[model samples]
Target: MTTCVITSHGGDFFGNDRHLTKLLTGLADYARGCLPADEREPLVKLLAAQQQTEVGTEQTIPAADAGQFAAQLRRIARHRYLRSTKLAEAATLLANAADRAAADGQPWTWRTEAA
Candidate 1:
């Protein structure tokens, strides 16, 4: 088993304004096709938790959502390559990308549902 960690913070940068839910849904679909069936649930749960946590803790959820998205990319690479090296590499790449995106000038968009 491998562990993936994701982190996000406030900053001004590029790639931050993009809609991450759409991106994440695409990535999840891609992972379902590529990764082992057993691994998919954990990945989904982790992502959901991360997103929810972000929404709860931060006024702006996009950066945290982006971090979760990056974590999914790391999970995909881990499933694909089945190597720690590739997992680490992908983790770094995705983390940086998410950070850059979060830093870009854009408002975080979110909708709340009635319970």
Candidate 2:
């Protein structure tokens, strides 16, 4: 399995890429239904961009959107049905990244590697 890792000053998280993609897809769907129209698009786009990255490659989620992104992810993580799942864990990880990024205004970096 390929392990996808998201790194930030706050912490790092690693999980199966396929599993993470599935979880993110769920999150995108949740965002579409629950978030306001303007807030929905960026997160959906971010999640899509993440799913598109190939193994052995890397991507960056810009600092400019960190706080809002974190807030959204936190909200998703808090969803009643999601709270106990890997999806919530992933959401929390990304939220942590955003929180850490706020201090230095650094982008969150994600990469995939052999497990």
Candidate 3:
């Protein structure tokens, strides 16, 4: 299986490609309306770019922006669109990882592993 891994000092998130895609899409959807264009585009674009890569390719949220992105993830986690789904749990995990990274002043990474 191809597994997605999002990690930081305080937390980590692991899921399969389908779940990863759901989490990313869910977050991006929320960001589109809630965040300004400039603040939303890079993260959304980066996630879109990552989805095109082979499993195991790694990507990072620049440290400077991790906090804002994490906040967005948390909001997505609470949003009605994802309620009662595994994707919501995945979003929460991703948020936790990014929140940890921001607190530690480090970048959070997203990557996949072949198992």
Candidate 4:
């Protein structure tokens, strides 16, 4: 089946669908698993002592550019800190979008409620 993108005349398609949720949750799980319990959140334990001290930077959260943010999140799986944080931010953005759309009585993506 050809998965259709629901978009507008000049705006990006809404990406708060099941796919985005799955990506965000899956990456978060992997990121936590990548490290032992004591080191899952490597952001705090910055690798400042290493040669590559760059803090795994990526483009700022693309709230208006859903597709781009989603693509970037999908690519950074190996960088657990980057992947985990980006996934969380992306999920928040999508959730906000879904909330706004629902409030406006427009077509909205069904999102999973955080437990």
Best by lDDT: 2
| Ranking of all predicted structures according to TM-score, beginning with the best and ending with the worst | 2, 3, 1, 4
Q: Ranking under lDDT, best-scoring first? A: 2, 3, 1, 4
Root-mean-square deviation of every model: 10.9, 3.7, 4.0, 14.9
Tens-place lDDT digits, model 3, residues 3-101: 444455434233222345544565566667656676778767755554456776777777668787777767766776565566567667766666777
lDDT of 2: 0.68
* CA displacement after TM-score superposition, residue 103 of candidate 3 (Å): 0.7
- The clash numbers for all candidates, in the given order, read 5, 0, 0, 0
Return the TM-score for each candidate structure. Answer: 0.34, 0.73, 0.68, 0.29
- lDDT digits (tens) for residues 1-115 of candidate 4: 2121121221246343332334444554554545456644432121111122222322122233434323333334334356356555544444455444544545433222322
TM-score of 3: 0.68
lDDT of each structure? 0.45, 0.68, 0.62, 0.36
Model 2: residues with Cα > 4 Å off, grouped in runs: 1-5, 10-19, 81-84
Clashing pairs in 3: none
lDDT of 1: 0.45
lDDT of 2 by residue, 1-115 (tens): 5344445554524321233555566677777766778777988887766566677777677787787888998888887756457777777877777777765788766665444
Give me the runs in candidate 1 sitting further than 4 Å from their true place.
1-19, 46-72, 75-115
Candidate 3 Cα misplacement greater than 4 A, ranges: 1-3, 10-39
